[model samples]
Target: MLINEGNTNVFIVTDAVLNKLGIPAKVTDYLDAKNISYHVYDGITPDPTFNVVEEGLRQSIAANCDAIIAIGGGSVIDAAKMIAMSQGNKCKPQQLIGILKARKPSAPLYCVPTTAGTGSEATLGAVISDDKTHQKALSIDPRMVPLAAAIDPIIMKGMPAHITADTGIDVLTHALEAWMSANASVETDYYAASAVKSVMHYLPLAYKDGGNLKAREEMGIAAHYGGIAFNKAGLGYVHAIAHQLGAYYSIPSWSC
Candidate 1:
C-alpha cells in the first residue's frame, strides 16, 4: 500500500499479531527506503474497542498524518477505518455509532491484508466494540473503503494452522451467507458459487501446508470473490450469529 503526502507524515494502525509475525518490519523497511515518514500504532487488540479507535485517532492526529495505511488482519484494518473516519467527527467513537450522518470526510486510506480473511480491505463496513455497553457497533459508509488494497501472497504464508483454519472458515461463511442473502443478484450468486468451490478445494490444503503457494493463491482469490459477493449482496444470519458469538465470548469473529 502506498500513501502519498507532500511532506506530511503517514500513520499505520495494526494489531500486535502482525508485529509478532514480523510483517510490520517488512513494511517499515520499504517505507524507509522510500524516505517516507511514518508511525505505527500496534496496540489494536482483537475485536477492537471504541477506546482503541480513539487512541489510534489521537496518534494519527498527533503525527500530522495526511494519509493512513493499515497492515494486518481484520481487527487492524477495522480500527484504521474508524480512525480515518473519526478525524473530522469530534464525537467519541462510541457516539458515532448508529449516526450515519457525517460532518466531514475522512483521510485517504489504504490496506494491506496480512491474512486471507475478513477482507476488510475491500468492504465498506467497520465493526467496533462498545466496551461500556458490551455490544458490537458497526459503522457503514462507502467512504470508509480503502482507496487501495495490496494483496500479496507472501504476507499470508506465515499463518499458523489454527489461524488458517479459522480464516478459511470465514471465507466460506462470507460466500455462503452472501448467496443466501435477500439482496443477492445473479452476479452475486456467480461469484459466491465460485468462491465456495475454491474455498472447498483449497482451504484444507493451505491449512495443511502453509508454504503451498498454489493453495495460498487460490485461497486469496476465493477471499476476494467472497468480499465482492458480500459487498454487493450483503450477508445474513450466519454473520449476525457469528458477531454475537464474538461479542459474547470475547473471541475473534473468525474463531468458532
Candidate 2:
C-alpha cells in the first residue's frame, strides 16, 4: 500500500525506549516480510528538540528515504513531523517552528502510535522543545497530518500502567476543553463527546489491565477524537498550564 503511494524508500522515526523494547518490530517485521527498503532513527527523546529532529533529518536524507513512518508515542511522532516537513522543504527543522512555515507539502508520512496518548497522528500541529531551556514551540500546518495512522491494540498493549492512566486523562482533558471552547461547533462537540464517553468508560479498564485489547482500542479512538475536537475548537488553560509545568518539572505533559 505504501509503495503504491510512492513510498519506495522509507525512514522510520522512533524513540530509544520503544526501540529497546522492540515495540516497533510489529511494523518492521511486516516490512521485512515484504522486503521493503527502510532505515530506523531511534534518537527521539522525551520532548524532542530541534537537535533531535535535525539528526533524524540527516539520517533520512543520507538514506535517500522518500517517505517517513513514525512509531511510538507523541514525542516521536512530533519529531517525525518536523523531519518530514524539513526534508520535504529541504530546510532546517527550526525554520518550520511557526504556523504555516512550510512553503511546500511535507513528505508522505504514516504513523503507528504505540501509546494511546497525545493523538498526534490526528493533529496538524507538532511541538518541539528547546534542548537547553526546555521551552516548547509549536508548528502548525495541515500538511503535517499523517497520510495514514494505524491504531492497533496489539502495539499499545505493553504500555506501563502509569503511562496508561496519565494518557487516558490527557484524552479526557482534550475532549473537555474542546467541548467547553467558545469555538466549539456541532462537529467538534460530537467528537469531543464521543471522546469523553470513551475515556470515562475505557480508561480504567485499560489502566488496570493493559492487555485488554478492547479497552486499548477504544482509548486510542478516544485520543484521536479528542485531537480532532481540539484541533478545531482549541484547548484551554489546563493544557496551557500543564505544558509549562511539564517543561519546568521535566515531566511528560500528560502527567502534568
Candidate 3:
C-alpha cells in the first residue's frame, strides 16, 4: 500500500528459497492489483557475491526500477542491500565495502523476511562476497537499512525444520553477543535481554511447528530486537572470529 501511493517501479530481490516455496505470489498479487510494474531477480546465492550484486543491478536498471523489495532469508536481504546501494551510489559492490563509503543514500529498500535470523532487514550492514575469490566483504552504511519490513508469519511458515532451528539459534546468538558487548548500554541490554527471552520462549515452538504463526511472529520480533541491540552495542570475539570464518568459507551469514 505504501508503494502504491507512489509511482514506484520495484525490483523484487529474493532467492530460490522463496521461489521454490511460492512465497512471491502475495507480493505479485499486491503489485498486480495496484497495476504496479515489477521485475523479479531471484538469482541470489547463499552468500552473495559482487557479481550477484552487479547482476541484480543490471536487471534493476534494465527494468528502470526506483525501489527494491527483498523477500527471503538473510542472503537475500544482504544481496538486496548491495543491489540497492550500488544503484544509488553508481558503483560496484566491491567499492562500497568496509565502513561507510556510500556517498549517497541507497534506493528506497524494503524487506519481507522468510526466516527469523540475521535480522538483516533491520541492520545497517551487508556482507557480500568477492566476485573472484568468493571472500566476504562488509558493506556498512546507515542507508543500507531497509525503510520498511514485512514479517508475515504466513510466508515464513514454509521454512524447513533445519533452517528453522538454525535461524532460531542465530537470533539467540545475536542477542547473546550483543548482551556481552563492552559497549552494552542500558537501552541495548534491555533489547538484547528481551530478544533472548523471546527466543527462549518461542524458538523451540517455531522449530517444532513451523505452522505456528504466534511462535513465528514472536521469533521474528526477537530477531528484530537482536538486530537493534547489536547495531547499538557492537559484538565481541565470537562475531569477530565468525566473520573471519565466514569470509574464508564463503558461507551464509546465518550459518556463521
Q: Stretches of candidate 2 above 4 Å error?
A: none
* Per-model TM values vs. the true structure: 0.94, 0.97, 0.95
- Tens digit of lDDT per residue, candidate 3, span 1-256? 4565484688999887677777887898898998888899989988777788899999999999999999998889999999999999988887898999999999889899989988888899998877666567888999899999988998888888889988888888889999999989999999999999999999889988999999999999898999999988887777677766776787765677
Model 1 lDDT, residue 178, Cα: 94
Worst 10 residues of 1 by lDDT: 1-10
- Candidate 2 TM-score, C-alpha based: 0.97
Candidate 2 — worst ten consecutive residues by lDDT sum? 243-252
54-101: candidate 2 lDDT, tens digit per residue = 999999999999999999899999999999999999999889888899
The digit string of per-residue lDDT tens for model 1 on 1-256 reads 3533353477888887787777888878887888888999999998999889989998988888888889988899989988888875655666556546556676778888878888788887889977877678998777778888888778888889889889989999999999999999999999899989999999989999999878888887788789889988998888888788887778898885
State each model's CA lDDT, in order. 0.84, 0.92, 0.87
Better of 1 and 3 by lDDT: 3
Q: Among these predicted structures, which one has the highest TM-score?
A: 2
- Among residues 3 or more apart in sequence or in different chains, the pairs in candidate 1 whose N, CA or C atoms overlap within 3 Å are none
| lDDT, candidate 1, at 15 | 82
Task: Give RMSD to native, each candidate.
Answer: 1.7, 1.0, 1.4
